[model samples]
Target chain A: MNIIISNTAGTPIYEQIKEQIKAAIFRGELKEGELLPSIRRLARDLRISVITTMRAYNDLEQEGFVVNMQGKGCYVQSQNADLLREHKLREVEKHLHASVVAARLCELSDDELLNMLKYFMNEEDEYE
Target chain B: MNNILELNGVFKSYKTFALEDITFALPRGFVMGFIGPNGAGKTTTIKLILNMLQRNAGTIKVFGKDNIFYEQEIKEKIGVVMDNTFYVDEWSLKDIERTLKPFYKRWDSGKYNSFLSDFRLDVNKKVKEISRGMKMKLMIAIALSHEADLLILDEPTSGLDAVARNELMEILSEFIEDENKGVLFSTHVTPDLEKIADYITVINNGRILYSGIKDDLLEKYVIIRGGLDVLDDEFKTKIIGCREHNVGFDGLIDSSVLPLLPKNIITERSNLDEIIVRFNNWRENK
Candidate 1:
């Protein structure tokens, strides 16, 4: 998995790490049971504090994205269908919230909003 | 988990400078970068830790024992690399190791040899013939060869080139793989600490300015820039370290005050260098 960190970003280093790991998991680049680098190894490689790395790993474990084994290291956890669906739903909810705000700002009717979304979805599918 | 090194209310004084109530702790498996300007008591505190200088007050502990009470035992478990070299100028790498090996109970000859080769140092080269980087490598090789749980270095990268400095950082990062190992290196080069230090203890004018995780220190302060018009007495009162110039006003402000700040002021996350500069400024202005 590719992970890049930017010191200038407003996001804290640990948050950047967590977001990247989550994205990689969602993208299927990191498969279930795939071993992640040991905390020290990742910290050394990234030139970041091990505490920052530990925080990221701890968050991942708490979110059920990874499992940390004593002495062995962290591994990607198996994502059940329900968990995957829940994650996708949360992601969609964020977009839907933004879309609702934009629709209200533009004073669009329900039919107009639905038609615009359909047009964009079909446009994206044509490229895919 | 036990602290690898602990200092409690440490106080020391000299004719020209004094370190007052200095305190911090380094947990095992982490590297704590001790930082300060010249005459900031960084070296004095280090000397106190090694029991080289007597403290006027307070206690220092290594491996849960008083530094003075178990000085010899503590010394055995501690590896030190100072700016000055104690090796004879004419001695070769092998001679240097052979002379110093007897002092440490756990010194590994094989490990020393391997490190020497890994560092590309010739065993036959005289100490005087080697470069500054080579000398530092030799020192680190010796430090690691003893299997010391704690490595204390003062300005180890001061005189080295950029490439050499990066190499040393890589070596240090690798050295902390063992959960029992802890490193405390004092340096003015903040970037090095930004890269690998888990915790940073910044001191100035013989006083502790800040001591905690490296990330938190970076996050705690912000650099604010705006026009001179933004410099009101109320805002100026909140500035940690700021300067007003003909162009505009630039200052350091604590992150907690950001939300209360006027929207016109520009704020950016402060780096370790900015934090040091601001602290130095705050001390100077005070």
Candidate 2:
């Protein structure tokens, strides 16, 4: 897995790794049962601490993106459709919340905000 | 494991400045970016760690061993790249290799060749003939070729182009693939540290200003900007650095207090560069 972390980015290094790996799994870039690099190997490759890599792996496992087999290694887990849907929904909810807050700050009317959202959604769909 | 490197109540002095009660640690296999303005005792701390300079007070430990007691032993396993190129002007890369081969027990010529190729450095180029970027690359190549557990670099990217800087960062990323390896990268260049530093230690005037995981800084500090009318004396005191103009004031604030900001004020996440610049400015003003 190729991951680059920004020190200046608001996110922590471990979280960056976790998020990237999750995104890869969501995009089907990493398949189920595929062995992920060892925490040590990933740490060394990324030039980060082993603890940071381990934290990312732990987070990935907790989020069900990957499973760690003690003494063996970590591997991509079979994606749970329900869990995936829930995760995606949560992400959309977050975006909606942010958009609403931004709209409120801008003093945009509900109708105007809805129209902007719809326009963006249409653009996204077109891109897809 | 405890910290990979730790200094407890450390004190060192030069004719002009003194490091007072300095204490910090770098957890294993993590890159700790050491930052401070010039004359902030960054190099002094490094010298203490490397036993190149004696400390008047406190314990210095490397990989959990007492630094003074294990100086020779510790030196063997740690790779160091300083700001100035140490080689003679006339020496070639091959000369450097021959000179360093005996110093490191785990030195591998084959690995060195691979690094040289990776950095695209010519072995025949004299130290003085090589560009500044090439010299830094050569130092990094030599540093990584040895199976050192820790890499300590002092201002390795101070004067390189963006491309060269990124290349060095990439090489560092690749080098840390050995789980046991760690990096102590000291630089005033906050942007490069922002790219790869796992933890950051900021020092000023021979004392540690801050030390912790890079995320902590991002999550816990913010830059607030607003008109002078909106900034109260109470709020101003809480800021680490504040600059005022007739138009407005901008300052770094603790994130926890961000909620207390006046409605018109703007609060945003502060990048490493802004944080360091503000910090140094504050130090200078103080």
Candidate 3:
């Protein structure tokens, strides 16, 4: 219900849902063993396709972020904090790699790239 | 992945208009833009889906259940926003919400209130006292609060300003962010669908002319402009619509046959509006 989506974001809809749920779990917004909304309920609430929500749930389950009980519905699963941290770090690395490639393409100097990153990090910190 | 709603070999008749062999599906999580010229059975198709009017023939299924057998269950999961507001004129936003809350088992008052605030709607304002845009926002708020899996909207942008329309699109885009929700947006405004619609089902003269992805619809057809010198018998047959000009002729060409054109003609990408207009015009003459 608190979800936001970007129409122009390169991320696919399912990935967006998956990443948001993961972030929510990581932030403890969704506590371990907490019950998540049913796929039908979430789809209706979000006005999204049930399949898209289902894919997100399935992906989350696969990632050990949630568990689906037969006929009972899905729930946030207990996670290894270390593993989650590693996963998050890997994602950041990939993003940084892409950013560096883009920065290189734009012919940004090391100082310029560092300044831009610092500015963005500071802006993001303010929001949180 | 299954059809949330489908009509097979469906037919409906009015005194002057009819829907013939109408078959289409709204797959789960996919938005199907139900498009057509005015009075071209777009509303009729929606009516058939809701069973507001009985179909003359064929079957309809919602959530893989026969429509007739699961009408109430289906209705409970479906959120409908028609072009016209059906609420009582004297009813306030709160009054409407109060009236509808008891009908949906999953109705969330908190969510409803939040939506009203987000949409900047006043709960005490009478339905008739609100502007058309505000009324639309109210309807959307109600629709979102009901926890319905499918949202069916008919001409939601018809009378709205660009900003309001963009707001509505943003809301819908967010709604579908979960991917479990599907939207059937019926509109004459092709440009809006150009931005958000995943699949398009276009009807004209009680028949489906095109039904598929927006990209495929754009890719499968093209607009070609050139002089009479560039025209030929083979070229004419492939045209969907053509218009004469002082200097030349411009027309729609099936992209599949683009190679058939002589080397000098200009072919450009066509959008939903151009395709719909050309198809309707061609049908009119035929």
User: What is each predicted model's overall lDDT from 0 to 1?
Assistant: 0.90, 0.84, 0.83
lDDT of 2 by residue, B162-256 (tens): 98888877877776655567889998887767756778888988888889888677667888888988778887788878999999999898888
i-RMS, each model, one decimal: 3.1, 3.5, 8.2
Task: Report the C-alpha lDDT of model 3 over B1-286, residue by residue, as the tens digit.
Answer: 5877788889988788888999888877777888888988898888888988898999988889988888988888888888779999999888988898888888999999999999988889899999888878888888888888889998988999999988887788777765577889999998877656778899999998877766567668888998898777767777887887789888898888877677567767787888888898888777
The predicted structure with the larger DockQ, 2 or 3, is 2
Off by over 4 Å in 1: A80-128
Which is the leading candidate under TM-score? Answer: 1
True contacts kept of 1: 0.56
| Model 1 lDDT at residue B171 | 89
Which of candidates 1 and 3 is the stronger one according to TM-score?
A: 1
lDDT of 2 at B231: 76
- Which of candidates 1 and 2 reaches a greater DockQ? 1
Comparing only chain A of model 3 with the true chain A, what is the TM-score?
0.77
What candidate 3 gets wrong by more than 4 Å, as runs, is: A1-128
RMSD of each: 3.9, 3.7, 10.3
* CAPRI class of candidate 2: acceptable
* Candidate 3 or 1, higher lDDT: 1
What interface Cα RMSD is found for model 2? 3.5
Q: Ten-residue segment with the worst summed lDDT in candidate 2 chain B?
A: B172-181
